[model samples]
Target: MKNLLKNGLMLLTGILMLATSCNQISDSESGGNGKIVLSLTDAPFPVSLVDKALVTIDKIEIRSTATVSSTTEVTTNSELFTVLYDGDPMEFDLLDLQNGITTELLSMDIAAGSYDLIRMHVTNASVLLKDGSNFDLKVPSGFASGLKIKMTPNLVIESGVESEVILDFDVSKSFVVQGNMKAKNGIKGFIFKPVLRATCQKYSGSVGGKVFENATTPIAEAHVQIIAADTILSSALTDAAGNYHMIGLPTGSYKVVCEKDGYTPVTVDPVVVKAREKTTLDIQMATATVTVNP
Candidate 1:
């Protein structure tokens, strides 16, 4: 009876030990792995504007590989992961450039790894520019030449984790310039057909009884007009402190006129504006009464 009891106890202890060892191994296998991520960002250059243009861009390719010289050993395929652009799935080509070369974006759940050599091939691009007349040919001086960015590269991706990469290229500077009127011509010619541009800035100053009499305090919401020749430009209303801005006008001499409900109309001297520049004009309306004789 004593021998049987001892045998039964030994059997129970062996089963418990085996179950514990199996659980430990399973946990180690499940939790010991890591991951990699890869991505591409922004375009390389600006878009070109020429006499006439039209274009479109299609696809881009990239290759990633591990390095033996380095300590980390990254040997895993991540072809199952996704590649996207502007939040869209972008098509790509995965190729082994050489024998024994694992050339592809890789993501693996392993202890940890290192990598090298991320090659890129940008392809499937298209561009289009409509008729030359579509562009505002009178572009400002010092405007930057346009270049199109085609493709960018994806360096590395650590899986079970997040990472970032950039892809971009530049298209040559070429855009249409269409317009009968050109700035290089003489001032009279350009001025006659000048590109209209105007800008305004606000100023605040208190108007005392000298400008408007009989009023306990200054009035608000005055009307301001900028007149050039027969053409009248911007008009604005004053705020609590009497400030306003009018923008986008052609270069010329302008008369500033200010009027309020209880104040006399005020007109300032002609303000001259240069091309592609802003001119400032402020006015204070005086108070006066008009009497009609029958």
Candidate 2:
């Protein structure tokens, strides 16, 4: 698979849809085809041993919902259009594209309508250990079917309007190891189970704050999660100062959860993040009571 992406014949056949473009059009220009753009972003996945998580994406697909009053639309599940991302397959380190940075996936003109689904083809995934060793991040299945990420709110492409969607690739939750730890590769090997969410810049916000064991002790390496509607939006690891931040969350009511080894977990509920804004939620973990047998 590595050879297929790196030096394969993909370049000759790879369709170049749209390059990095900052496109804007007036309400008048938004007809015929609406400009659609996609950017790749990631959420935190904290691990001690794994140094780098490199993932490769080959193609992108889209299925639209008919919103135009006059035009006919396809509502069938099998109806999918390949959004052109013409280029050599790109390998990205999930850890690097965090906080705020992102890479453009594609920008092209598509028939104006509302899109219900966006799928990404992750051709390959591999990890680099801290010790400079590397291995293929095995995928049990789903690559052929594509990583199906549902746009909770349908993505509308108005005539002459520019629409953009950001894929919040959660690396921490996406990659999983199965089976017994007693084995060599851990769970049948490193499985790339992708976890992703679609959010638009117009509707997303960020969450950040410091965590504490109490009023005095800062909690480092704490797992901080931001969840909305029972779904985890993003997660981060508290730094040395117990500071953590989760970005690219679709604006909504959410809860912040803080957890660490040997400490009691805490959740701060009713934390609201407005569009294009940041919400701060501080947390404190009570120590777990220890039982001793004399």
Candidate 3:
């Protein structure tokens, strides 16, 4: 996805929202075992300069809280986690998955239980510019211990049921660009600090709409946010077409805020989002500076 920047600041936030469909064929399993599908998606990045951002993941690991007979002692270290993907090292071009797009990486059947932690072992990462110059990104401590992400509320897999977890890797926040991107030899390098947000498909919903000014002109790069109880749940910027979409949001009533530097921010209240459904909330933002129409 294209992440547009303003005044050297990253304003576009991406969501790794789960797709409604799974590409991988589900395993035919009966009772006791639950199937979990893991998917990867990237938030927006600067598409004008960066050609491709590559991330190599060795494997994925999950920690389940299910105990044997409620008497087994829970191990707190690596032993508590199970390998979700370890067959072959998977490399993904994060730019390929953007703007409500996602790729199913793994589908596996495991014992039904509650999982609280998920980790991804990164083997390598790099960034390629449109000019063909590439630089290797530094993955801090990601190779040995992996990037650990703890779920706020543990994910539960039911018996004989299929579930999905969408990992939104916000590339805008993860890859910190060094030097001035607009100056000559500006991009010295990039530091890779992967930020992943997990959302379960069971209780997640979606919101999408177009941001326009005066209900006529589509406004690109406008920041749209979903707010609930004064907390910012999710945020994203309008694409080139002035459309914004946020998925994998928990079902609830949210206040949708649309804002840009030159336009007056608009907030729509009680924008209800239903589970597994999409709510369309088109926003019309007024111009901050009045047009005199001389």
Candidate 4:
């Protein structure tokens, strides 16, 4: 009888353990699948003139969609993806030009679902030329356009999967003309026209420096402006490291200027923007001296 009781207890314990293991296996397979990733690639082109600078982009807009199971609950719209320019603001509308496919920027993160088509729009950012001898150039507001893009055979997003889409185009074949030249009659004929081209090359760099207290130690939150000729191209704030990145600029010359309260402004000249290059410019701010007369 003692042996039988011991055997019964052991059998019960083994059965319980087996039941627990089976339950765990079912739970492991019950949870929904993982997220889907969509990537976009742009077509190659020759460097084209924009604002008198050569530029090229590798990719445009990217978007994704996913179908949720009845068991899955979506808590927020944040999962819906969007695109943003390097220095531009975030775009929310999937149909708007600013968020469309023509831009070098692309969207990321779309859950698994059934999507009919991923739409994209591409257009050039408009440039406005300021009058006078200086010829200051400015990018006007609301100048982007969305050209429609349709992908065939609707993309499928499976749970726990990723996908990629290509937005390819050739730039060497694409060209645009601007400006006119003087003719033999000297009546302002079209002779020297500016042709814009696009090419893929190494076009990346950085600009940074220090804002100091009497040339010692770094200062934080100092305003830095990158100027190209008469134009203020970009700006950044110095961090605790007294560093900043002047990004998304075309090949050209620039000047770095730093300003802060209770300090004299400092300027660094001839900051060049080059293709596939990184340029560093550092500046030191001077303490302001006050003159008081009684």
- The clash numbers for all candidates, in the given order, read 45, 9, 0, 22
**Per-residue lDDT of model 2, residues 81-129, tens digit only:** 5465635777778766654456765567888766666656677888776
TM-scores of all predicted structures: 0.27, 0.74, 0.78, 0.36
lDDT of 4 at 86: 27
Candidate 3: segments with Cα more than 4 A from true spot:
1-31, 67-76, 182-185, 214-216, 228-232, 287-294
Candidate 1: give its CA RMSD in angstroms: 29.2
Error (Å) of candidate 3 at residue 283 is 2.0
TM-score: model 2 vs. ground truth: 0.74
Report the C-alpha lDDT of model 1 over 1-294, residue by residue, as the tens digit.
000000000000000000000001122223333343222111111112212222211322222322233443322223411222122333321110100111123332333222222222222222223232332223222211111111111122333432222111101211212233224531121111111110111111111112222244444556555666644443444544555443323345677666776678888767665543555554556667878899
**TM-score of model 3 (CA atoms):** 0.78
User: lDDT tens digits, residues 1-294, model 3?
Assistant: 223210110111111122222122222422377888766665667766889888888767788754323654333366778887776777888777665667777677877777767767778888898988899977785336777766757777777877877776777667778878879877888887676667776677788989887555898878777787886656677777799787667777889877787888888898998887999888888879777976
> Candidate 4 — worst ten consecutive residues by lDDT sum?
9-18
Worst 10 residues of 1 by lDDT: 9-18
For every candidate in turn, the CA RMSD to the true structure comes to: 29.2, 7.9, 7.5, 24.2
Q: At residue 57, what lDDT does model 3 achieve?
A: 80
User: Total backbone clashes of model 2?
Assistant: 9
lDDT of 1 at 24: 12
Q: Please, what is the whole-model Cα lDDT of each candidate in the order they appear?
A: 0.28, 0.62, 0.69, 0.34
- Which pairs clash in the backbone of model 3? none
Off by over 4 Å in 4: 1-201, 214-216
